[model samples]
Target chain A: MPAAIETRNLTKQWGDLKAVDKLDLVVNEGECYAFLGRNGSGKSTTARMLLDFIRPTGGSSELLGGSGSDPDIRARVGYLPGDLNLPRTMTGRDAFNYFGGLRPSGESDVRDSLVERFGLDPTRPVRELSTGNRRKVGLILAFMNNPELLILDEPTSGLDPVLQEEFRDLLAERKADGATIWLTSHVMAEVARVADRVGLINEGKLVKELTFEELRHQATTEITFGFAEPVPPSAFEDVTSVAAVTQDGVDLVLSLNGPVGAVLKRAAELDAIRVETEQNDLDTIFIQLLSGEEQS
Target chain B: MSATLSVYRRWIRDRRLSTVSWTLGIVVIIVATAAFYPSLGSTTASIADGSDSGEAMSSLLGLSSGIDPSTPLGYLWISLYANIVPWTLMALGVALGTAAIASDEDTGALEYLLSGPVTRTQVAFARFAAAVSVLLLVSFLSGLSMVLSLPFFDLTESVTTTAPDGSSTTAPGATVGDIATGTFSSFAVALGLTGIAFLIGAATGRKGITLGGASAVGIGGYVLYTLSSMTSSLDFLTWLSPWRWYVDDVMLINGLTWDVTLPFITATLCLLIGWQAFLHRDLQSS
Candidate 1:
């Protein structure tokens, strides 16, 4: 079987800027691939190109073994844009019916069930809804088709903690049911929960690709030590455990991936005022990647 | 149901308020204007006798030949149907056509719609067709208002025409055929402008450009036609204006002419070019 999503040298250029530059990616069938990128990193642009909303300047992309412009292929895919804007007069139910009616036997039962699950008021016009509620409507529309593939941009952006958890659970269920999902998100924790693999993109280029196991096994720790006097970040540079260091006022925050004992001993020897340690997860790795720090 | 048809239905449903308001407003204008026909009586004929100011007034109002202002059809032409009704219908068309693609695209709603199982071709055709249908409906209502008031205005009376050479002739008064054909010609002119708006909207996907550009072209065309009518040196420019095809013969009084088909032909050409441009261009992000 062909990969659910594939791209070869997919690029988009606007005058002097390359929004997506020579990107090559593939998501196998039933795989949950998360694209991690910062704001204006071309993640949304890639999603738009994949759906044929914006034509790529060069190279190509395929969705579900067919071109993005193919209506037949599109019918089997569910998409949610990052910024969801509906007509002001259309109620949630009206939107559901309008978009759903376009598909061949669009899943109404699924739509209704998802609406109930998300606690969406289908009777209310979308313009009156809050940002989070509008996101709920977008989510319901994406999941309504029971599609074979899903392309979601910032899927859980405005959801509260409880609803975010519900969304993650729903995503896991969909994954287990053998659907391929490709999503872009700034929320590292959400990606850590549901993503099987992740690719980090920076300035329109893929910087790193890591599996869930590799990401989890990072096991990096953040240690913050306050000195009586200001200390430079280079003070603990030779320690094998120290991956990166940043100074905040009189405090030195060290990212330790190996063993923290050596760094702790050194800090103690230096007569630090206070030393605090916390486990640093995927978010730390993301920041490190974007900030030009070398990964261990 | 066909996807194109479904889109058409949805678009029409989306603009139901606009269609209702324009259609009702036109009907009211036509009725109110027709009510004055009885009171004006012979004064209408005196204006058509062509005094220096009267001729200038007729030209400015787009009351050209084949219309005798003494009769009901000619009265409506000089009073409201010729310029007012057509311009109002054209305004509706321009508004609808501009919103058809550009408004949806700018609002970010069209991107979501395209994500469905529909194609860009379907969207383009559906929107254009829906705008045309609503325009025709407005024109139909305008004609119906005049037809319903025909008996009230005693429009069945024959019109006596006095030629420039001092020759007199009699012409039959307004009939249902005249009303139907006149409405069709009016609709054709509006549709032509609507098509231009659709083309601009599809090509650019910007509401401001679509509305402003289409209005400029329409108003410019009218200005050119009016100036050409007054100056023989600029008369050739009339061929390019829908106003010429519309008012040159004054359809309600003169009966139908071959010029009625020109707008549809031009509109189809615009649609083809626009549909292709829209299908290939990148959708503007909201």
Candidate 2:
């Protein structure tokens, strides 16, 4: 089957600034893809283009195998805008009901389930809800309809830790049921936990695309070994490219990039005991990628 | 089609309280004016009777009271046109109609609505229909007030008499039916103004600017028409104003002519243009 969401060289320009530039993305069915980017990095712009909220200036996008602004395409897609400003006069329950009524085959208990799961107060007016509560309401509205494709921008924002974990699980369940999810976030840990494949965007361009396993391989490992005797600076030569090494008396800390076997052999040759190795998380990989450092 | 109608129903539910308040406010103004100016009827009668004093007063009040005081239908016509109809009704219509669409967009609720299965045409038409309904309701209620009060003034009686040239005078009572027809003329005028305001709101996407700019142009047109009517040098300018076609005294006392058709036609054209603009413009997120 065709990809659930595809953009062909999609470009959006606001005056001289290119908000999104010639972005070509294909999100496959039943896969959870995370778009990782820093502030002003075109993630939100890309999401908006996918949803047809704003017309692309130089290229085109398709949602659910249909071209721009197609009604059938929109019917199968659910979107949560980066800026969620609901009407202040309406209650959270009313807003959800209004959107729910628009769906052709919406679940009857979706709203109630969401309200109960999130512990959201249905009686409170939207204006009275806190920012986090408002974000919860927006999440419920976007996810409750069980749309075929879900495009969420910064989905976990303003949510507490507990709700964030619940949201991640909900996304996983949706993916298991053959739904496509296109998520954008600056939170690397969350992206690492949920995203099967990740794309890093910078200055309106997709700079890197890697699967979770590839990302783990590219990450560095921390090695700490206590030497029986003081070792020379060249004692670990030809073992690995150490990013940083700090020695406190006899215990030595080394941040190394490469196979763990190399580091282990080098430590054994140095007569070191009690050596520990821990893999670097997604946060380290993100910082290294965005900072113009290549991962070998 | 059902979805389109649902949007209109939603709009009515959202704005019912505000509509009632606006209509009530306009009705209060009309009633107060009618109560304070009871001689307004006598002045209309004198002008209809064609007496010298009646003629002077009719000129001063900018009215034409027909040919006989005993049958003062002309005065009733003047009251309906000038005081009861267009002035208050049209202002309310423009304010309420412009707010109906532009306010939703301004506050970002429009995106939520448009993102649904409803098309842009459905939204535009539904909003237009709802606004027009509110305008008609206000006009009808105000007209009803005037109709119910006619018997209190004993102005519902018909009479017959002998003329100076031996001709018989058969004058008819100013029935509720006549009053309704007269009110409808003003309704047509107000409807046109409401359409113009709706067009402005759609084009600009700003409720305040649309309401303010339309109100200025509307009130300015009325002022220009009144000023031009008083001056021989500016008489030609009166034809350019929308208010010229809606003048209460002229429509009620002199009766509407082919000249009144221009405003209604212009209004329909403007509404079509507005709908087209709404359909093509990108939905604003606001």
Candidate 3:
């Protein structure tokens, strides 16, 4: 596949501080790559480097297979900075007109529709708007051009839940239209819903990359089987479906991975009385990965 | 429209209120000062006649040889053009130049703007041009105010001063051309300061450093020239100050001279150097 965004050992260093360590990333055309990282973990720095806002101390990056420093290449890119700042006096409508005219694409009804979808007032100046509204303007600016690639930093930051869902739907539509997305977001659910691949960055390094399925597989839940009599921890010891087993009086608490079918069968054979399952979401998995990385 | 033009227009629009306010403030000062010309013109000239304090005052007024302070051109030069006009314009220039990149970059707006389909070079030049445009507008309006009010304030009448040694000297009435020369020279000086401010801002991308550096050059130049004029000991240091030639040339009363072109050269060089630095350096995070 043609690469929409590619970086080879990209590094940005300020003396002893490395804002973006040697990172090698490649998001193929039509792929939604979720760049997940904790705060100050080089996510925004990497995005800025990708867009050529900051010069890398080493290596290089290419956008749409062309240099980010090239204006023509950037014209095909829609970027939403984490902290979007326009002139305070500029109205939302003015921003659309000004930024929209820069691209080869015309100012289409898509912009107006996006405005309505985000529930933003086009007439009010940016200073008068709330944080969520400001974020809406940033979103509209990023999505308005229908660019080939969207590089968004904290795309849903400061957004209400409904607007965030609306933004996600917009992202889905754009993705269906063959647009490649490279975004950094703390919302794990949002990432799980849309991303094909997720890259975990920490301490200026790209720590791990995995597909959504693989990430979901790492998401483990706790299942406890209650019984009329005491069950030894060894009851489910040999079961691969149960990652960890512990005895709590007459109950068996199992760290469950994948399906609970095998455990259910084992519990039935053992004449288990009740089965209660506690589900784990992606947020736990992400936190575990980051904390694990920090410990190491 | 081209992105450069669009960016330029947007910058201009953003500063429209500020530019208008600066122009109006300057025009008011010019008219207000001119209003006093009819009342205090001769008295000021008589006070400057051969006293030690008078020579110091002449130096302060930027008076040239044989130019009586009582004459219309001399009076306007001493009262407004020499100090107030150029210094204020220079201050404005410094502010505009800093605003061109440093202020916006400081607020992070410049970074957002650069995220568009515009090159750093385009934005740099667009902003600098906008800053210069505003400075020129203010300078032009100031000169126009002085010229239009010249007749109402009796500054259009030629003055003859008789020397104590029985000799008489006649100085020409202030002309519109003289007003143009004075305004353009003041604008030029301010342009040089503007360039310095732009260069500092571009190279450093910090507002405090840019403002401080440019202001130091301006205020330091004045102090250097003033001290140099007072004593021969500081005369060698005078060459370092742009005011040396500016005050010595007294373009308003002495008419146009080679000194008027130096600031233009300074401005172009600063712009070129600053633009190159801006293109090469990383933007400071807001």
Candidate 4:
């Protein structure tokens, strides 16, 4: 498939600081690539460079096979900045009309649907709207045009959970329509659900890129096995799928790296009471991934 | 419509209320000054006579080429056109120029606007045009207000004065064409400042810096020109000041001159410099 977004050694430098170092990224068409990074880790800077808001000191980027600097290329793209700001006097409706008018596909019907979906008041001046409402306006502006590629930065920062979920649903709907999505969000669950793949960046460097399945694979499953009597932590050590094993009074907790079949077999052989399993969520995984990068 | 037009239209639409407010404010000031010309014309003329040979007062009031401050045109020039109108326009022009890009950039609004289909070039040019349009609008309305107040205030009637030696002098009344000339010259002065402010704002995207830089040009130029009139030491530096030509030409009463084109030329240079800076640099916010 053609790449929807691609960067070749994309770099941006500010005096002594390297905002975005030599980086390579490829997000294929119809793919939802979630760019994950810590705060001030250059995710937003990268996004800004990709959209030509700032020029890279080195290298270049392209969207939909064209330079991002080209207006015609940007016309086929939708973008949402991390902090959405409009003219203070502009109403939500005005933002839609003004921003939407630049592109050919800003159908009023799509705009109306988005406004309703996000539960935004169209008539209030943007200055009066709360951050979440302003974000809704930004989201609507980004999605209203139905562009071929969507570049969103911290897309759900100020949204309530309900609205965040709604936004996820909208992303899903757009993904179903084959629109390429390149987003950077701290909401790990949102990334887990919507992004087919994720790229982790550390201090301006692209550290690792992995499919959601690979990310989950890095997340070990913790299972606890209970026995009538205190159990030693070494019982599941022989099981190839168990990475680590520990004991708590009458239960044994095992961190599994693979299928639970062998651990279950071992647990059944020894357990006289109960069994429980816990999965490491992406939030923990995201932290671990970054902390690991920091360590090295 | 094209992206440039769309951006331009939105800028004008969003500023509609403020635009009306500024225009009305200018109109009220210009008209009120003209209205007072009837009651204060004689006193103002005498004041002009009192300061007639005082070089400092002449420089301050921009009395040039035998302008009698008692005349309708002279009083209007001293009261409104000389300082108030051009100063007000310059202040407003700086504001509009800063608003063109710097104000929006301060709030990250410019970055958001740039992320759309519009090119930075389109935004820079469109916003500069929009700002110029508003400045022109306020200028036209204020001039119209002065013109409308002329007949009501006896500004159309010429006045004659007699000296103790039986010598007499007559100062001509104000005319609609004079008002146009004054307003246009004042606009040109303000436009020059606006272009400077726009250039600074586009180059820096910092409101304080843009306002300060352009304001320095306007106020500093005036001060430099005024001081240079009092001494010969600063005369060489006076050439850099817009007030040098403005007060010397005093287009309000003397009619239009070739010097009027100086401000326009300065404004074009500013636009080109500012545009090049904006086109090449990274935005302040993003």
Pick the DockQ winner: 4
Better structure of 1 and 2 per TM-score: 1
What TM-score does chain A of each model score against the native chain A? 0.87, 0.90, 0.92, 0.92
- lDDT value, residue B104 of candidate 3: 87
**Ranked by lDDT, top first:** 4, 3, 1, 2
Question: Which docking category, incorrect, acceptable, medium or high, applies to candidate 4?
Answer: medium
- Worst lDDT run of 10 residues, candidate 4 chain B, spans B47-56
lDDT tens digits, residues B79-191, model 4?
Answer: 98889999999999999999999999988999888877788889989999999999999999999999989999999999898889999988788899999999999999999
| Candidate 2, lDDT over the whole model | 0.74
Residue-by-residue lDDT tens digits, candidate 1, B227-259? 776678888877888887787778876778888
Predicted candidate 2 versus true structure: per-residue lDDT over A1-296, tens digit per residue: 57988888999888999988899998888888999999889998787667655678988888778854665677677777665666556788877766777667567597688889899998888778998898888888888888888888898888899999988888888888889999999878986777889999988988889898898888887888888887765666555577677776677778887556776777888889677777778787788888873232
For candidate 2, the chain B TM-score comes to: 0.80
Tell me model 1's lDDT, rounded to 2 decimals.
0.87
Model 2 bad stretches (over 4 Å):
A86-89, A221-239, A244-255, A259-288, A293-296, B37-85, B153-174, B230-240, B254-263
Q: Local distance difference test, per candidate?
A: 0.87, 0.74, 0.88, 0.89
* lDDT for position A70 in model 4: 87
Q: Rank by TM-score, descending?
A: 4, 3, 1, 2
Model 4 alpha-carbon miss at residue A167, Å: 1.3
